[model samples]
Target: MLLKTFGWSFAVTAAGLALAGVLWGWKGLAIVGILSILEISLSFDNAVINAGVLRKMNAFWQKIFLTVGILIAVFGMRLVFPVIIVAITAKMGPLEAVDLAINNKDKYEHLVTAAHPAIAAFGGMFLLMIFLDFIFEERDIKWLGWLERPLAKLGKLETLSIVVALLVLLVTAMTFATDVAHGGGDKTATVLLAGVAGLLTYLIVGGISGYFEDKLEEEEEEVEEAEEAERAEKAASGAQKGSQGATVVGLAGKAAFFLFLYLEVIDASFSFDGVIGAFAITNDIFEMALGLGIGAMYIRSLTVYLVRKGTLDDYVYLEHGAHYAIGALAAILLITIKYEIHEVITGLIGIVLIGASYWSSVVRNRREEAAGGEDAESKAEVTSGV
Candidate 1:
């Protein structure tokens, strides 16, 4: 599997270069390779987390995640989200804004940098959730029985990430609430607005859309149960096949559509900070796209590798690790929202947390094994009456 992945990685990297060559000859290819590596390195945790989610989906949805899902990451999030960010924050026309970004790279970069703090705040809160969840949750072992009910009930505090974001937001709101007074003007206000938009998007679509989707899913399941009960006798015959076919088809379509839908949103969430971070390295859209696009391929491959290797199932704590990474990244992104921290720092923090989780998981596995061995020995002695 490793060899296969390496082969594909090479194929993708080479293909990306070739595509770059077509676009702008040797310079583009050089930029493409460098950016791809940068993106892949920066997004390691994302790939691990995506694998965990992608594995939960059916094969069809997994394919959708790879194919269409890549498009969303590469083009939708990387290229377009920046423009959307500019559009919301800037006074210029949309095309004119992009043109400004292209022409006046430094000025547009200032806009991207200005937008980073709120982005960091959101990602930081998210990453903090994942981290706390990792430490407290009974994912691999149930060592902390006392904390379980409370953490489970209250859904964990995630105090650090949230507190930081609120502070940042408060400062931002007060400092930049009215554009006329503050030199920063409406730019800060626009960022806060964008943060609300992100929260609302997550709330409305993830919260509301998810609610209706769940309702429809339940109803569909009920109908299927009823159908199964009615068709049980005739299930062996061709007559029932004609009747049951519609039910099966409907369920399959619904599942596929939702699987695709969720992946898209998840990809968007994962890409949010990374896209913002890309501008930090270079504002040239070509480099940003190629680098981020290459990074997107790695994310795809990681998802596939996880699905193929059943790594999530094997590691047990990996999903927890990824979520922790996401929580941290979310927090870091939120920081970018108000402050001017480097993207590399944010990415590194996420990577370190994930690495720590994996290390912890290893130590945890050893301890559990030792405990089990001791228990088995005690049981053996008891059986022997010794």
Candidate 2:
């Protein structure tokens, strides 16, 4: 399973490193290697969150995610997207942006950094909404029962998540975003506009996805009802009972398409920091793309691996951990608009939260097993006494 899942990632890693070495010798290879590692570490929680969404998709959509989705993530987000940002911000053509990226690395990096307030506001708010929605929703399993239970109860209030998100964005725009020390200009209006854009994007995409999901659930419930009726009829006739076939309802058509869009947008939001942060390591745009592309391939593979292995099901708190990490990343992105925060700190927060969740899951599983064993032993003793 490991090879089946990660074979392409390994291949990409080898090719990326080989290309880097051929272009810039040992130093290039080393930088590319470090960038790849950094991207992977920073986006591990992204893989977890992606898996949670991907598992709901069917085989065809999953294939599209691995193939076409990787292209968008690699070229679109890693390469083209930054150029577009620079082009728009610098008031230049796309070709000019490309030239600046290749010939004048320092200028390109500076332009990108200068645009950080708008970028951070958009991406940060989008991610913040994701975290808020997840926390607000009621679920049968709560990892942090004390906190989550109360939040879920409060979730009954309509638009609570959006209200809180708007408040945060407003405060940040008025305070942190207005500081000129970070980027030499007041970006209050820029932050407000971009943040609202991000918020609206989330609402539109999430609303569409939710509608399709509801339709899918209704279809599945009807199918189950029909199956139950068939069983009842068979029992009435005293026919020989046979095993019923399993029913699988996979998202398709418009539902699958919008879900795909949602997943890509989520990837974009996650990549915002990684893309900006890579400039610190190397101002070479192509080198950053190659290294980050390789890392993205591995993340896609890891997402599929988790889905295929049912890892999220086994470690029930894993999704909660990922969302919590996302919340932390969102906050970090907003904070970095005023003050720089190291990528290591961002990565470690995710690792620690996910590690704690995994450990807690293990403990929960062991307790459940012990209780089951005790109950079985008691049953056996009672039967013997009878």
Candidate 3:
């Protein structure tokens, strides 16, 4: 299973490294290797979150995610998207931006870095909404019950997540985003506008996905109801045969389509920091694309692996850990607007949270097993005595 899942990722890694070596010698190969590892380390939580959404999709959409989605991630987000951002921010045409990226590496990096405030605000707000929605919604499993319980109760209030996300964006814009100590400019308006745009994108995409999901659920319920009625009629007519299976609709059509859009937007939001941070390592666009692209392939593969293996179902707290990690990343992105935080710190926070949650899940499973054993033993003893 592991080989089947990661075979393509390994192949891509080898090809990418070979290309990097050919292009810029050993140094290029090493940078690409580092960038690949960096993207994977930073995006493990993203994979977990992606798996949670991808599992709801059917086989066709899953295939599309691996194929079409990888192209969008590798080329669109890693390569073209950065150029588009540079073009828009620098008030230049796309060709000019491409020329700048290719010919004037330092200036290109500077322009991209200069656009960091808006990028951070937009990505940060989008991620903050994701984290807020996850924590606020009531779930059967609660990893951080102490905090999540109260938040889930409050989640019953309509638009509470949006209200809290907007408040955070406002405070961040007024405070850290506008701090001149980090860079010499008041970016209040820029941050606010970008943040609102991010927030709105989440709402629109998530709202449409939710609408389709509700429709899917209603259809499933109707099918089950019809099946139940059929079973009742069969039993009442002195029939002893089993009822036929009900054909349930999967998340496909418009539902899967919008959900795919939501996933891509989420992936884009997650990539903002990685794309910007790559400039710190190398100014070469091709190298960045190659390295990040390889890492993205692995992430997509891992998402599929998790869904197929039911890893999330086994480790209940894993999703919680991922969201908490996302919450931390969102806060870090907002904080980084005014302060420099190492990528190592960002990666470590995710690893630690996920690690803790996994351990907790193991402990919970053990306790349940022990309780089951005790109950079984007690019943045996009672039966023997009787």
Count of steric clashes across candidates, in order: 34, 0, 0
Worst 10 residues of 2 by lDDT: 238-247
User: Candidate 2, clashing residue pairs?
Assistant: none
| Superior candidate under TM-score, 1 versus 2 | 2
Scored against the true structure, residue 360 in model 2 reaches a CA lDDT of: 91
lDDT of 3 at 84: 91
lDDT string for model 2 (1-386, tens) is 99999999999999999999999999999989998998899999999999999998888889999999999999999999999999999999999999999999999999999999889999999999999999999999999999999999999999999999999999999889878445677899999999999999999997898788777777667667866886877542323122121222344456778888999999999899999899888999889999899999999999999999999999999999999999999999888888899999999999999999999999989999999999999999999999
Please rank every candidate by TM-score, starting with the best.
3, 2, 1
Query: What are the runs in model 2 whose C-alpha is more than 4 Å off?
Result: 180-182, 230-251
lDDT per residue, candidate 3, 1-386, as tens digits? 99988898989998899999998999999999999998998999999999999999999999999999999999999999989989998899999999999999989888888888888889999999999999989999899899999999999999998999999989988998766333458888888999999999999999999899888777667656765886877543323212212223344467898999999998998898889878779999999999999999999999999999999999999999999999999998888888888888888999999889989999999999999999999999999999
RMSD of 3: 3.4
lDDT of 3 at 182: 38
lDDT of 1 by residue, 1-386 (tens): 77675555567677878888998788777777767766776678877866754665567777777777778788888887777767765666789878977799887777765555455444443444444545544343433346545555454554443354455555655653434221244555555665555544444444453454565567568767867866775545656556666665566556556656655665666676667666545678767887788778777877788789876665666565566567666655554443556667767776786777677667777988999999999999999995
Model 3 lDDT, residue 282, Cα: 98
- Report how far residue 386 has shifted in candidate 1, in Å: 13
| Residue pairs in collision within model 3 | none
TM-score of each: 0.75, 0.94, 0.94
